[model samples]
Target: MTNYELNMKYYFAPLEGITSYTYRNVHHELFPGLDAYFAPFIQPKQTHVLETREKKDIDPVNNSGITLVPQIMANTADNFLWAAQELAARGYDTVNLNLGCPRATIVTRHKGSGMLADLDTLERFLDDIYNGVANNGPKISLKTRIGKDDANCAQKLISLYNKYPLPELIIHPRTQKDMYTGTPRWDVLEDCLRISKHAICLNGNIFSPADHQELTARFPTEKYPNIKAMMLGRGLIADPVLHREITQNRPVTQSELKRYHDTLFKAWDALNYGTSTLLHRTSELWFYLGCMFKDADKYVHKIRKAKNIPTYQAAVEQLFEHCEPGGYFSAP
Candidate 1:
């Protein structure tokens, strides 16, 4: 049940509204297991101006000493290239393109996974990226789902991806239709690993160290050696000490959780997000952290009902002081 001895590379999947500079910096300081942390996708405009929020997320001052990669979500190669040039000028050596987002709002716009439905267009887009600026600017990596409709579509995508000099192709093993439901289609991913010319990283259903073990075993070093990296998001949020457990070979301590939570809380409080706004954000975090408690439902409810910062803090304290940590809650 332990894959502690395996030398696996780790990446923190960018969860929008959650894994921003604040979360990334704190997590990086607390747990040093991750090789890189991806910033949530920044949608660049035709003007090619990085938004204030996007600029802040990639600010060297904010992300100092953290191996952070900024992700750009653009359907067009022009928009993508413009943003890539901007990022590279900002000193980012690598930038990730988001082709994996499944939200209806994003997909309906013919972006994210929706673009995967058209091979001709997607190829042209990639061609523009590589031929135009990718050769001269920051090396671009991709985060994609298998396809927009059928998981089998990954096979064709891989054939197309093989034509490019991509450093890595991170696959989530799910079609857009699947969203976050069901299990990942590892069968399709296995085929992807077999034919992909580039290195591949698995990025789905890795909720625990054992889950990662199962994935590594299936794609063992003896056979599928190209698959070595895994991206974690909800799993890390659900158990903030997960990286420590996986990389440091340690157990999740209450003290560790307290420190992590308090760090995040104090940081958010500094933003002066207003009492209700701050409470809402903190409560949302507890929605994942609460999963580790024995009576998760009760603790989660109390955290949700909390009206102010003090009440929220009190509810969290109650969970840590009275409730034991161990449950079967999985991130959605």
Candidate 2:
């Protein structure tokens, strides 16, 4: 078998509300294969000020020892430029434009995937931002869905993306309306591989080592030279050592998972966000992590219903002690 670890770059996808800086730091320390971690979208307001939480999320001190690419979600060029300049000043070498977020709230605002609905506006916004950026500023990349409602929109979208000097173009290959449903538009992605001028990073539906192998087989580097990286979001969350499994072809041990769970619990607990916030945050993690254990639905439900820290900790302990690891995580 070919050792893909020697040839491919792995990026951790930016998932809002889950893959925060703390999560990134812990994952980097323990697993150690992801090339870059894309931070959740930072929606810049006209005020051109980063919120306290946003500042903390992208703070160099908070993100030390990791290659973090801060993402910006904006409809107008001014807001995008302001945020990009701020990130550049903070020493980020590249800023990712979030054009692929499929949430309805973001879409209705004509940001995210909604930008694909109006190619004219999208082109103009791109023009202004590309022209507005200073010569010495950080390079701009894009993360986009194929279209808002139709997959065919990728044709024009790719054309416009080709006009810019993007360092990388990360495509999720699903229309905004798809909203994580159905399989990703692989046919559309194949077209992008054949025609796009910039380096292309594939995202969406990469949940296992088999999936990674299938993608590599389908889009061999010799045939699709533009396909440079693979991005994992929910899959990586479900199995923290997923990158290791794919590259090293080894299963994660139960002891490693227990240690990771314990350390993560303590790290989040130390944030002192209070009992309610801590419970809510840890519960969100269990929603994904629960899938790593075989037949863990019963324990997972208990964790979710946990109202206090003691109950949550007890439920987690029961799960680790009783359930076996090595199960596949199917997206819910």
Candidate 3:
């Protein structure tokens, strides 16, 4: 296989409710260069076919230009296999299992971020996947947090990972306890690269090329040299041209930002979603979009509290009117 950097894709990580086809389509239409996108974790083992909403999100008809890696949330071996089959049934060649969900509702079930806390269980989970339950596009990838709550958890987890033959290991080097609180532990990633069996794709706080450079400089992937492939989530929302910056090595222009904001607004308008719905979608995005402005916090407040579309549109128009977006990566 090609080394990580050579094979690296400027990918968009699946954020539940945020990175769906509507959002993905809108993003691609406005700002291009996303290599592949991960669909938000679909509880693969769920009792039925893709529900109305998910069915649409994963629909091949909608995602023509972009490569998509369907992501599944599995709590057990059965869940993993079931989800994989479902994706295959839908004609996907590969799938990603979320080992990084930190939400309490998800983790409490030994799914998501909680799943990483137990090595033995995780081992079994993988064994089941490799055992051939997933006949259609059995290829599986893992997206993970360092541990449930501590640094040691990642140490033990990495050892376990070294034994498996995963296609790729996407690591966000922070514990579940952090809940995105502090900086990612790069040292843990360094240790992981030394022992991991699969290709290592770095994730966590890759908002800008600077962040990407920092990881490459510190970790220095021995086999790959520079593992450029990374998963961008909040970073993309913070700055949609992130892929452009990473690949083209150029800053986004004012026209680019306005185009993105306008496209998103138009998509929402056509969907005929109520003002509250539009506000809800825009607000989730502004969590990072706020960073692009002069008075970010104030702009965020204006977008968030707007009760209706006329009000919300006026706010959005105002925010983008003066300040231009700039970031390697930014925060909520």
Number of the top TM-score candidate: 2
Local accuracy by lDDT, each model: 0.83, 0.89, 0.77
Deviation in angstroms for 248 in model 1? 4.0
Lowest lDDT 10-residue stretch of candidate 1 = 1-10
Per-residue lDDT of 8 in model 3: 61
TM-score rank, highest first? 2, 1, 3
On the 0 to 100 scale, the lDDT of residue 292 in model 3 is 64
Q: Per-residue error at 111 for model 3, in Å?
A: 0.4
lDDT of 3 by residue, 169-219 (tens): 888888888787668888787777666667767788888877766766676
> Against the correct fold, how does model 1 do in TM-score?
0.95
Candidate 2 scores a C-alpha RMSD against the true structure in Å of 1.1
Candidate 2 lDDT, tens digit per residue, 209-228? Answer: 98888888888888888888
Runs of candidate 2 with Cα error greater than 4 angstroms are: 1-3
Q: List the residue pairs that clash in candidate 3.
A: 207-328, 207-329, 208-328
Cα error, candidate 3, residue 68 (Å): 0.1
